[model samples]
Each structure stands twice: as C-alpha cells, then as structure tokens.
Target: MTDPRQLAFAHRRSADQDRLQPAHHPVVIVGAGPVGLAAALGFAARGQASTVIDRKASLSDGNRAICWSKRTLEIMDRLGAAEALLDKGVTWRTGKVFLDDRLIYTFDLLPEAGHRMPAFVNLQQFLFEHYAIEAAKRTGLVDLRWQEDVTGIEPTTDGALLSITTPVGSYRILADWVIAADGARSTLRRLMGLGFEGRVFADQFLICDIHIKMDRPVERWFWFDPPFNRGRSALLHRQAGDVWRLDFQVGSEADRDAEVKPENVAKRVRAMLGEDIDFTFEWISLYRFQSRRLKRFRHGRVLFAGDAAHQMSPFGARGGNSGVQDADNLVWKLDLVLRDQAPERLLDSYDAERIPAADENLLNTTRSTDFIAPKSMASRILRDGVLALAASEPFARRLVNSGRLSVAATYDGSPLNTPDGFTAGDCPTTRPGAAALDAPLSDGWLLAALDRGFTSAWFCAEGISADALARMEAASARTTLPVKPLIVSDATACTRYGAASTPACFLFRPDGYIAARWRSIPPDAIAAALARATGR
Candidate 1:
C-alpha cells in the first residue's frame, strides 16, 4: 500500500497560460491549502468561481494540525467536506490534566447533546486538505492550478494582477479579488511590504507522531511535570491510523537537532509509556509558538486568511479552525460584493470581525503558554500551587490552563449586528453577532435547515400568527437578498433561542451568525437589518 501523504497532484497547463491577453478571473486564491480550498468551495456554493494557485503539488506532508473543532466541522459540512473527516478522524470530547504522577482534573468539552458534530476530531492536516480538495473538485467551479507559483503581485484600485510562474513558462492574470492564504511566511505579504505585529515566545516544543496500537481512550492528555520529561509540560493526543501525537516542551536552551534524534525521543516516549511499550516514529519536528497576526487582514483587493493573516500557539487548536472560519466569514461577503448585491464596504466587516477574533485567540493562547511554561520563578510557583490544589479544589480547577480550547468567535460589536430588540435572558447564546447554536429539529438539524443564505428564524410556541407570517413575507419581498423563513416549533429549539412563550424572530447572516433579533416581527425591521448587514 502506498502512503497517502506521498500522493502528489499532477500539474497541467491551463488555458489561461496560453491566452494572448491577460485573462480576468473574479477571484484568485494563492495557496491550495485547507483555507484556500475552503474559500474556493465556499464561493462555488454561492455560484461563484475562483482560480486557486499553489506552489506545492501535493497536500500537507505530515500530521500538522490534528485537532478540528466542532465549529470548524460545521463550516466544513457546509463546504461538503465534513463526512470524510468525521469518518476517519478520532472523535474526542474529554481532556485530562495531570500534575507529576497524579491526575489533577478531567474536563468535558461538550457537556450537552443534540449537536450534529462532535466537540473535536483528531485528523492529520493532510487528510483534512485531501477531503477539502475532493469537495472542491466536485463543485466544478474551482480551477486549482498546482505547482504554479505566484511570483509577483501588482495591486490595483479594484483588484490585483498576479504574475504566475510554472515549470513550462510564466503568465499574468487579472483577478478582481485576491485571497492570500499562502501561510506564515507568506510571499504575497512580503511583496506587499507587510509584517505581523505580535509576540513570539522563547520556549520551543518538540512534536513527535508515533504509530502504535494501544487500548487508551481517545482524549487529550496534558501533564505539567511528568516523569518522562521532568520540569516540562507534555501533551498527548490520539490521531487516526493508529498514530499518537506527542508534544514535549523543551526549554529554549535545548538543542533542536539533539532533541529530534530518534533515540532521544524514544527515551522520552519510553519514560512516558513505560519501557515495555513499542512504537515507531512517523514524524518528528521542532516548533516555536508565536501569537502574532498581520495588523490588518484586508489590504485593498488582496485579503489574507489562515496563517497568512494570523498565527497562534497550537495549544488550543485555534490556528486551522480559525483560518477555516475566516474563509467562511469572508467568502459570502465577497460573493455578495461580486454579484453587486452588497456594497464593497461590506468586505470591511471581515476585518472588523476577524481581527477581534484573532486578538481573542492571541490573548487566550498567550495565557495558555504563560501558564504551561512560566517565564519567572514567581509565576512557576503560582502555577505549581494552582496545579497542586486543582486535584481537589474546584476553585483551583477553574484557574488551571492546559489550554483554553477553540470556540467560534462572536462578532459582539460588529457594525453588521443590529441592537437586540428584546432581552434574551434565558438564552444569551443566540444574541446578535453570535454564531447560531445547533439543535435537533423535527426533521433535521437546525444548521442544516439554515442552508446557505440569510435566514429569518421565527420562534413561536403558539405557532406563527397570520399577521407575523404576512410581515415575514413582506420583509422577504422587500429585500433583493435571499432571506429564507424558518419557523421554529420544536420545544427544545424554542427554549434554546429563548422564545418558548412570546413570539421572537432572528435575522441570521449568510454565515449563520445572528444579525438581529426581535420580540415581534416588525414590518420593516428585517429589510432594514438586511441593509445594515450587507453594508448598503
């Protein structure tokens, strides 16, 4: 059997390469990684086409980002890539924290039920990219060009001109919009003379992927000071294909080359899993955590997503998950802009919303790093004391920070979000700018019912009134934007949205985020909210 990671995509010359004049594309994406492919699929779902260019001819080489959050899975499901991921990925919802040899506390990521996706799935980055690529190909809208390097970029007032170089020759293409998902050392960002503004920690970590069969449950296990590597933090997670990801914090002074040696790594593994256990090395690497992001995600017609826009410590599994969400947030807005359905200024909201999300991730990851690897003796003492107390004390458990974990970012103060018309005391989770919570409906899941456009969810226990139905019909007719009406009669969903008694309505953006809500369906409120949401 051939190794899946070794599979390479064949590069073929595109017709654009032979065009006498520069061919213009509506959207051109640099990098065919997860984010870029996702952007392609997202635009395709919106009936838009995009040309994706990547220097690489294959998927990711190693088991790079292995943790996929539920929010990410939800977004992937919309893009038509979640089924394969869920089938092969290890589903995990619990994590254990330890202090030396003693287990401090174990936490459940998802305490509630009724969600279609699990809390997190552990799958290799290569597999994630492969599934996305397969989905994009199925759409027949993404023009993926492999081994095509974006050598130069000239920013125009309305778009960009990208100079492409391949093995055969070079060609120039005009893109009405450019998406740069090239990654941390982004060539496009450098060409534009942009740089990230944030902190890079001093500590280094050694990551080793080992293939072994064990009876251990699929869960995240983190240790503060284990016997395997005394005075350092360690993390272990089970991935698909009988592989386990192990992360060991090797202080800044440790020699990178020495730590990566198979013998040295094996010694640490033996210490952790006992000398009798057997394992084979699949991949080994050394990395330093950085909580940094570009000052702005949008640079005129050129937009950045994923590592090109932001980077964070891998502790919380926020990097890839946040990157996919960036695509989800951006593609719909861009699609509307392309179709002339919304003002160009609507794209600016991407910056307003995602920048704050990036900041939140940076803040949380920085805190996690600080707690895991204390910079000073004072901080170390405090962390140790907290860890010691966490075993029995609930208060100390709250203070423990193995990693805060990834969650969807809510656009709390976004200009697109309308002020809440009514108090949602019972369900604060469905507030304006919040991601719509998923719940089981009579027929299917709530998210599946939302289905690819703006949605007006009317929650009425007593059933929608004739006047409210007419108001909703009037609102839909008033706007050119697609706003599908969803009548929520499910008791569980009604309670989840805090509309069990009185009638309530919520205007959800195309990205499944609440734009506004009301106690009653106002005659002109949905139209006005749609106008604001699209930057009219």
Candidate 2:
C-alpha cells in the first residue's frame, strides 16, 4: 500500500490565465491550507462564492497539526467535514501528567456527557486538508487554483487587485475582499510591509512520528524530567494508522540536522518506548517555539487568518484549532457585509474579537512554553516543585501547564453581543458573546438543529405556547435576516440553557454565538438585537 501523504494534486490551467482583463471575484482567499479552505466552505454555507489560490500543487506532507479540539470539530461539522475526520481520527479525552517515572495526575477535558463531538481527535494535517478540500468541492462555490502564486497586491478603494503567477504566465485578478491564509512566512504580509509583534523562545523541540504495533490507550501523556530524556520534558500522543507522535524537548543548543537523524531519533525513541519494541520511522522534524501575532488582523480590503495572523508554541494545539475558528468567526460577518445586510463596520468587529482571541492563545502558549522549558534555574525549580506536589495536592496540580489545551474563545465584551436580559437562570456557558454549548435534543444535537444561520432557540418545558410561537413567527416574518426558529422541549437541553422553569428565547448569530436572549419573544427586541449583532 502506498502512503496517502505522498499523493499529489494535479494542477490544471484555469480560464483566468487566458483572461483578456482581470477577472473579478467577490472574495479571494490566498493559500488553500486548512484555514483558507474552511473559509471558502464557510462562505459557501452562507450562499457566497470564493476563489482559493495556493502556490503548492499538493497537500501538506508529514504529520503537522494532529490534535483537533471539540470546538474545532463542531465548526468543521458545520462545514460538512467533521464526519470524515471523526471516522479516521483517534478520539481521546483523558490525559496523564508525569513527574519523572511517577504518574502525577490525570485530567479529563470533557467531564460531561451530553455533547455530540468528543473532547479531542488526533488526525494528520494532510488528511484534514483532504477532507476540507472535498467539502469545498461539494459546495461548488469554491474555485481552487493550485500552483498559483500571489506575487503582488494593490489595495483599491472598494477592493484589492492581486497579481498571480502560474506555470504559463502571470495575470491580475480583483476581489472585493482578500483573506491571507498563507502560513507564518506570508507573502501577503511582506507585500503589505507588516510584521508580527511578540516573543520567540530560544528552546527547540524534536518531533518523531513512528509506526509500531502496540496497544497503548488513546490518551495524552506528558512527562517532566522522564528517564528517557532526563531534565527535559516529553509528550506522547496516539494518532490514527498505528502511528504515534513523540515530542522531546531538545535544548536550543542541539543541532537541527543531528537531532533529526534516523539513528539519533531512534535512540531517543528506544529509550522512551523500551529497546525491545519494534518501530519504523515515519517522519521527524525540529521546531523552535514562538508566540507571536500580527498587531491587527484586518487591513482595509485584506484580512489575515491562521499563521498569517498569529503563531504560538505547538504544545497547546492552539495554532490550527484557533485558525479554523478564525474562519468560522469571519465568514458569517463577511457574508452579511457582502449581502448589504450589515454595515462595513461589522468587519471591524472581526479584528476586535479575534485579536483578543489571538492574544489569549499567545499568552497561554507562552506560559506553557515557559513551564515546559524553563529558561532560568529559579523557574525550573518552581516548575519541578509544582510537579512534585501535583501527585497528591489538588491545588498544586492546577499549577501544572503541559500546553493548556485549546478551547473555544469567548468574546466577553464584543460590541456585537447584546447584554443578557435574564436577571437570573441564564446558562453561563451560553451567555452573551460565548459560543453555543452543544446539548442533546430529542431528535438530534442542539448545534445541528441550529445549523448555519441566525437562530431563535425557544426553550420551554411543555413546548412553546401558541401566543409565544405566533409572536416569534411574526418577528421572523418581519425581519429581512432569516432566523430559524427552534423549539426545544428536551429536558437536558432546556436545563442546559436555563429555560427549564422560566421560558427563554435566545437569539443566536450565524456563527453559533449568542446574540441576545429574552424571557419572551418580543418583536421589537429581536429587531434591535439583530441590528446590533449585524452592526446596522
């Protein structure tokens, strides 16, 4: 059997190459990696079309980002790619932390059991891109042009003009909006003369992907000062296809070439997995840690997402997961703007919300890096002491940070969110500016029922009253923006939203975040909240 990672996508010539004039598109996405692809699919979900361009003719190689968070999976589920990923990825929730050879503590990311998606899934980046590509194709709204390099960019009064190069020749294209999803070394960022502002750690880490026949439980295991690599930290994760990813904290002084050498990597693997265990090398690479991001995500007609906007240490699995969420947050706003349903100022909210999100990820990843690879003796001592006490002390265990895994970011003070109307009994998890919490309904999941649109979730114990239902129907009929009305009588879902006793109606944005909630459906309040949510 051939390795799926080695498969290359064919690059066919596009009609744009033969255009007499610059072809115009409503949206153009640079770099068809996971972020760009997801953005295209997101726009498509809102009845918008996009053109995606990538310099590479093939999907990413190697096992790049392997951990997909539940929030990310939910977003992908909305984009129609989650089922394939869930089928092929390893689902895990429990993680064990170790101090040397002794187990310190165990943690479960998702302790509750009502959600549809798992806590985390381990799948290769290539496979993720593959599934997203298929989803994009199914929408028929994405025009993917591989091996097309963006060479120049000119911001216009209404849009931007892009100079692209292909094997045949160069051509120009115009887009009302351009999304820069090109990786950390972004050509678009350079052309715009923008630079990232943050810290770059001196420590380096070595990643080794090995295939072996072993029966290890699907769980995250992190070690501090283990026997295999004394004085250094290590992480172990199980991936699909019997592949295991091992990350060892090799010091800054280690030679990049020497560390990745098969013999040297094998030596480290043998020490960790016992010399008797047989394994074959799949991939090996070394990376330096950095927690940096662009000062802003939006620049007039151009917007940045993924590595192009921010970068952080990989320990937390925040980089890829957060990038996908960036697409989720952006597309709905962009779609509304394109359709003239919202003011242009709504785009500013994307910067307002996502910048803080990037900062949060950077802060947490930086702290994780500092704890995992302490720079000074005092810091190392503090980390070690905390690890030692974590075995028995519950409070001390809270101090342990082995890449504080990725979680959905809450836009606590976003301008788009309306203040909660309920005096009490509102669910904290589904409060204004927070992502909608997934819960089990009588027929399907809450999120699936919400779908990809503005929703008015009416939670009541004995079903919606005729008066309330008639009011909600009238409100929906009056609004230009379609709001799908969902009547939830499920006990679990009603309790989750704090609508068991007091009937509540929660207005959700297209991105699945709470916009506003009311004790009863009021036509005027719904109109005002919708106006505020869309920046009218």
Every model's TM-score: 0.98, 0.98
Question: Model 2, residue 361: what's the lDDT?
Answer: 95
Candidate 2 TM-score versus the reference: 0.98
Instruction: Report the lDDT tens digits of candidate 1 across residue range 358-441.
Output: 999989999999999899999999999999889889899989999999999999999999988876464678899999889888
Number of colliding residue pairs in model 1: 0
lDDT of 2 by residue, 1-536 (tens): 46666667677788877889999999999988889988999998878989999998678867899999999999999878899899999999999999999988789999999999999999988888988998899999999998899999999989999999988888999999999999888999999999888888889899999999889899999999999999999999999899999999999899988999999999999999998989998889899998889998999989999999999999889999999999999999999899888999999999989999999999999999989999999998999889988888899988999989999999989999898888754478778888889999878999999957788878898875787777778888777688887788898888888888988889998888999987888888887888889988
Give the RMSD in angstroms, all C-alphas superposed, for model 2. Answer: 1.3
Model 2 / residue 473 / CA error / Å: 1.1
RMSD of each: 1.3, 1.3
Clash pairs, candidate 2, are: none
Model-by-model lDDT, in order? 0.90, 0.90
Off by over 4 Å in 1: 424-426, 464-467
